[model samples]
Target: MTLPGLLSATVAEAIELVGDVRAVRRTLETLVDLGLGYLTLGEDTPALSGGEAQRLKLAGQMGRTQRDAVFVFDEPSVGLHPLDVRTLVHVLDRLVDNGATVLVIEHDLDLIANADWVIDMGPGGGAAGGRLVARGTPEQIAADDDSLTGGHLRRHLGG
Candidate 1:
């Protein structure tokens, strides 16, 4: 759906459609209360902060009836602060817990750290980089010689 259309739905309607209305409202209100900022609903498509967009997308997915489908998400953590990153991770974990296979392409080390398995593509960034240089748990990947993500995660994990 269009961004504006997504935004135009009342907080209640949006919540009800995906997951649970009551639960979603509680979640959204908590974010707003925490000063994440206002969510403006516009005529065509509402303007959304990057974090807001990501959260909405996730919520929609959570509400879906489809099962056993591979869900590929590109940089799903794009606009969140560290705390929100944790929240996003929890949401994703819930999806995995519910039996969904999630493939996420992201640079955020924290989110990457939570993956059941990670496929890190690089040695470099372009044509030379599309190759898979690493694949494993966050711990295993952190020890891989060819993984750039390994170093970043190692530092983050204090290894």
Candidate 2:
């Protein structure tokens, strides 16, 4: 359903409306995975948190034929619980498995650690710096003593 179509129903209500259809039930499962089982589809779109919006978009892509596509996300882990973040990771993994290339601009350590490669920018944020401080696999970044990301990653990696 479109946003206007959903304006009167909670997601749970939408699921009930469909009555035992596998696809609708899977959507509720996706919402729960994203820590959004409590959402009313009637809620204003602009009121959603960043993580909520990102996950909603992901939900839309569910079961689609995806290949040769590039998906970009900015700070998708924001406002997500660690467990929810794990769910988000699985979604991204599925995208890759379906042959999409995913690029995420993020600062969350778990997300960063899970990346196959990383480009860490800055000696400082904004005008204070624009240099590429490091670029490597997460383990390589963690080994760079001068990178701030390295320090946090080191701790996260327990190294």
Candidate 3:
């Protein structure tokens, strides 16, 4: 139904399923605390600022105990201020460290620079694009002449 309602229901179900109300309550409290700064859980689909929504979704996924699923995120940094972007990056890194393959489609160079593996699609943005222009560590991408991503990345790094 509504966002808050959905979140509440999901949280309740999770608590019941896990049979650990204390742990679930603690986790929910942590999420709410985090949300207090950037999100407003509304009656229907919380009126989340872009970054808050992204972070909340990510937190929910990270809270899962599953270890072998492929997680895909599209522009996870869409509305974050630079500071929040850094926080989001750290969260992603933690997820990777915990044994998950994260595939993210993003245009934020800073975040891309920290990725373990980056697959850049280009030559151009639309009908003129769709091929892999570069794929490597941030350094390799920065040094490659064939990649548009390299130029922007190099500039950002002042290389």
Candidate 4:
């Protein structure tokens, strides 16, 4: 016997049915981070965008207790606002502090600036790229004339 209606309830509706208020609240926060706050549990998983799916996976990983792990992310800031980027950075920073190695492939200067280390790639993209242009802290990257990323970072930082 199955309660199809109950099983198909929206996230908001299902949260109402959960006994643990804190857990529901935490789940809501995670959903918000994934930009899925507007979604209902009734929404099919296949309807999610690639970024949404990635974030959902990241959210699940965030709850795990993993040490000495390597986490890689691609453009996590793709759909996030500046404030949301800050939140995402905070989470990544926490993971790093907790002994996880986070390697993010991003073009967002804000995220780059907050990183402990950066490996700037490419003298150019596509057929002209795959070279390591620079590697250092944000300050060093910003000062490296060989790095296009550094030029942009320098401008962004008003250096």
How do the predictions measure up, each by TM-score? 0.72, 0.85, 0.74, 0.81
In model 4, the Cα lDDT at residue 74 comes to 87
Tens digit per residue, CA lDDT, model 4, 124-152: 89988898999999999999999999999
Worst 10 residues of 4 by lDDT: 1-10
- Whole-structure CA lDDT of model 3: 0.71
Best by the lDDT measure: 2
Error of 3 at 97 (Å): 1.1
Compose the digit string of candidate 2's lDDT tens values, residues 52-95. 89878878886787798888998988888888788788888888
Considering lDDT, which of the candidate structures 1 and 3 is the better prediction for this target? 3
lDDT of 3 by residue, 9-52 (tens): 54334333445568666665545433323332332446655555
Candidate 1 local Cα displacement, residue 68, angstroms: 1.2
Query: Candidate 1 versus the native: TM-score?
Result: 0.72
lDDT of 2 at 11: 74
RMSD after Cα superposition, model 1: 6.2
Using lDDT, rank the candidates from best to worst. 2, 4, 3, 1
lDDT against the true structure, per candidate, is 0.70, 0.84, 0.71, 0.79
What digit string (tens of lDDT, one per residue) describes model 1 on residues 1-159? 566776776554455444545765776654443324334434223566554665665655665654686777777676667786786777677778778888888999998888889889888888778888989999999998679999999998899
